[model samples]
Target: MVRRIGLTGGIGSGKSTVAGLLVAQGAVLVDTDAIARSIAQAGGIAMPALEAAFGRSVIAADGGLDRAAMRQIVFADADAKRRLESVLHPLIGTETQRQAAAAGEDAVVVFDVPLLVESGRWRAIVDRVLVVDATEATQRKRVVARSGWTPEAVDAVIAQQAPRRLRRAAADAVIFNESMTLAELETEVRGLWKQWAAATTR
Candidate 1:
């Protein structure tokens, strides 16, 4: 049987790095955030609904969703975020299902969902949940170094996500990312890949 793994982490926790390593090892990755961006792009399926709900102000000159403008509006207003999610979530879900179905029969599919813990619905669908974890300070420093975001801005985004404790509790496996070098991280991922491969074959 195919192993459906739900992989998640907070911003700057190196979840994407881990996902990339897994993909290199032949895992089929379904990244919901990427899917969300695709469906909100110019001429995407979600565009009509988003345009109807948020109006032209949230649509860019290129006919794509004005991501920066929408981000500001959604962060400022809870109702706006809900309205946006209502339009985008179903489309993302359908695309995710289609992608998973298209993967080879023996593939180990990983769903990279940033909000896996917050969403609550993924637990039932995935065989295991793997959370890439790091200290809050580590996350803050990484984000600042990589994205040039102010500490306060990083904190604001982290504040909006599920707390670290809740995410750790929800995880079936936790990959601690702080203090690890890239080589060490790759080794850890290799070990995980071997373990998951063994489990699936049995």
Candidate 2:
């Protein structure tokens, strides 16, 4: 049996970096972001559905989904977000499950989900949920720097998510991403990887 590890975190918490480390060690990396992008790509499995729901303006001139335009609309309207998720979530879920099932029996699989805690659907499927955590200040700074979002925009998004304390309480394993050096981070990841490998292989 392959072990499905759920990697989750708030924006800017470094969950993606940890997922990369897991990938480096040979875990099959299944990221929702990539899946979402694929679904939105022109002529993709989900593009027709998206175009039907959101209208053609959301599609770029080249025919691919205009993610930036969709993001702006979704962020501004909760209903828009819900509708978009309704269309994409099932498709993403189906694809993710299919890929996980197809991973070799000895595979160590990791699902990098940005909203795993908020979604509440993964708990039944994942063997373990690993959360990468950082302080609010750290998150704000990092997000603002990376996305060019204002502090207010960052806070608004954070406010819509499950609180850090709540997520930490629900986590089976937690990685503190507040301020460790890269080398230290890799060492921690390596230790966790070996432990996961041993547990799953047995």
Candidate 3:
């Protein structure tokens, strides 16, 4: 069996970026977000369940899930968010596990999960957790710049995630992304990949 590496961080902390670098170094990247998107597409695996839960309003003009609208609703309503998760998380988990299992002994599967820390269900599936970390200020600046969100919006997202201290404590490895150039980040990721390859092969 292959090892499952859970890579995660709060919004805009560069978890995706690190996962990309890892993929470049031969790790099979299993993006939970991408799986969610696929499962939410029209006539997708999770679409019927989601529509049954939230009604047809969550569907977009193209018949896909209206991600923007769903984001707004979830941010405003805790119960709605939980309901959405209940409908989607299992699908994502199943696909992720399917991919990981198919990879088998040759795989170094990296789960790029944004909610790994908050999602208690993940700990059971992942063999190790790699946290991409950055300072709060750095996170705020990056998220705001990328998403055009207000400080309050960024703070709201940060607050909803597991705190940095707790995430760090849970980490089997940490990638500190503050002030690092892309080249430097790649080098660090390559080193980590080698480490993973060695550790998992043994």
Candidate 4:
């Protein structure tokens, strides 16, 4: 049988990098964020509901979701966040499952969910949870370096996510990706992949 592994981490914890490493190990990846992005594009499945709920202001000139505008609205208002999640979550969930189902047995399927710890529903769906962890300082530094977001903005986002302890508690495996070189990270993931591949194929 295929093994479904849930992968998550705080923003700027190098989760996406780790996921890319895992993919190189002959694993199949089902990424929720990618699916959400797809559905938020022009003429995509989730655009109509988004436009209806938030109006034309949240739509880009190209007829896609104006991500910046939506982000501002949702972060400032809980109800707006909820409404946005209500529109996107089901679609993301459905596509997630569809992709997972299509990964054949003997494949190690990694479900890349950024909010796996907070979602409550993802734990039961995956056989294992792998958390990519980093210190809050590292998280803040990375986000600011890469995204050019203000320190205050990064702080707000980090504050909103699941605390590090809770994510550690939920993890079946954890990758502490703080201040590590890319080569070292890749080596760690490769070693872990051998173990998982053996476990699933055995």
Candidate 5:
């Protein structure tokens, strides 16, 4: 059977980097972020529901989700965030499951879930959770430098995420990415992938 892995990390924790390494090592990747983009794009599966729930204010001129407008609303309003997630979560879940079901039985299927720790519904589906860890200062610095987000914006995002300790507690294994070089991180993930891929393929 497939080994379903739930991978998570705070913004700028290098979680996507780790997922890329796993994919490079032959793991089948199902990225929730990518799926969300597809589903929120023009004519996507989630468009109608999203438009119905949030109205035209959240829709861009191109008929896709107006992410900036939605972000502005959700960041200020908790209820809006919940309502948005309610519309997108089920559809994201359905598509996530469909992709996993389509993978080869022996595949090491890695679900790259940015919000896995916050979602509270992934434990039943994943065989293990891999958390990518880094200090808050490091996270904030990295995110601000990379995404051009203000310190306040980064702080806002981190505030909404599961705290570092909470994420670490939920982890079956944790990768501390604070000081690693790209090559070193890649080596580490490749080693894990060899072991995990071997298990499922065997």
Candidate 6:
């Protein structure tokens, strides 16, 4: 049987970096965010529903989602966010499950979910939850430097996510990423990868 692990963290927590390392070491990564993006792309499965819900304004000239416009609207209106999720979640969920199922019986599959704790749906499916954690200050600084997002904007996103303490409490394993070098982070991930591999084989 494949051991399914839920890998999650807040923005700038280096979750994607950890996921990359695991993939290099043979873990099958089911990235929900990527799936969501694909499903909202030009002529994607979710585009028709999004068009019906928000109209053509939210769809770009290329027929893909106008993500920036939609982001602005959704952030300003809670109802809009819910509406968008309703359109995309079922499709994303179905694709994620299909990808996991295709990873083969002996693989170690990692579901990289940005909102694992907030969603409250992944815990039942994953054998373990690995949170890549960093300090709030670190997260803010990293986001500002990498994305050029205003500090206030970053804070608003953090506010919308589950608190750090709550994520820690929910984690079955955690990688503290603050102040860690890339090499150190890779080493930590490698250790965890070994553990999961052993568990799956047993």
- Highest TM-score scorer: 4
For model 3, how does the per-residue alpha-carbon lDDT over 1-202 read when each residue is reduced to its tens digit?
Answer: 3377899998888988998888887788889899999989977888788888888889898788998788778989999999998998878878987887887766788888888888787788778899999999999999999989999888888888899998998898999999999999998888877776656655
Q: Is candidate 1 or candidate 4 better by TM-score?
A: 4
lDDT of 2 by residue, 85-186 (tens): 999999999988888878876788899988898998888878888999999899999999998999988887788778999889878889999998888889
In candidate 3, position 125 carries an lDDT of: 78
Candidate 3, lDDT over the whole model: 0.86
Which segments of candidate 3 are over 4 A away from where they belong?
199-202
Q: Write the per-residue lDDT of candidate 1 for residues 1-202, one digit (tens) a residue.
A: 4389899999999999999998887789999999999988999899999999999999999999998799879888999999998998889999999999999667799999999999999999998889999999999999999989899888877988899999999998899999999999999988887876656744
Which of candidates 1 and 2 reaches a greater TM-score?
A: 1
lDDT agreement with native, every candidate: 0.91, 0.87, 0.86, 0.90, 0.89, 0.91
Using lDDT as the measure, name the better of candidate 1 and candidate 2.
1
- The collision pairs in model 3 are none
Model 5: per-residue lDDT, tens digit, 60-108? Answer: 9999999878988899999999999999988998998899889867778
- Which runs of model 5 end up more than 4 angstroms from their true locations? none
Write down the lDDT that model 6 would get. Answer: 0.91
Off by over 4 Å in 1: 199-202
Ten contiguous residues minimizing lDDT sum, candidate 3: 193-202
Report lDDT (Cα) of residue 75, candidate 3: 88
TM-scores across all candidates? 0.93, 0.91, 0.90, 0.95, 0.94, 0.95
Q: Using TM-score as the measure, name the better of candidate 5 and candidate 6.
A: 6
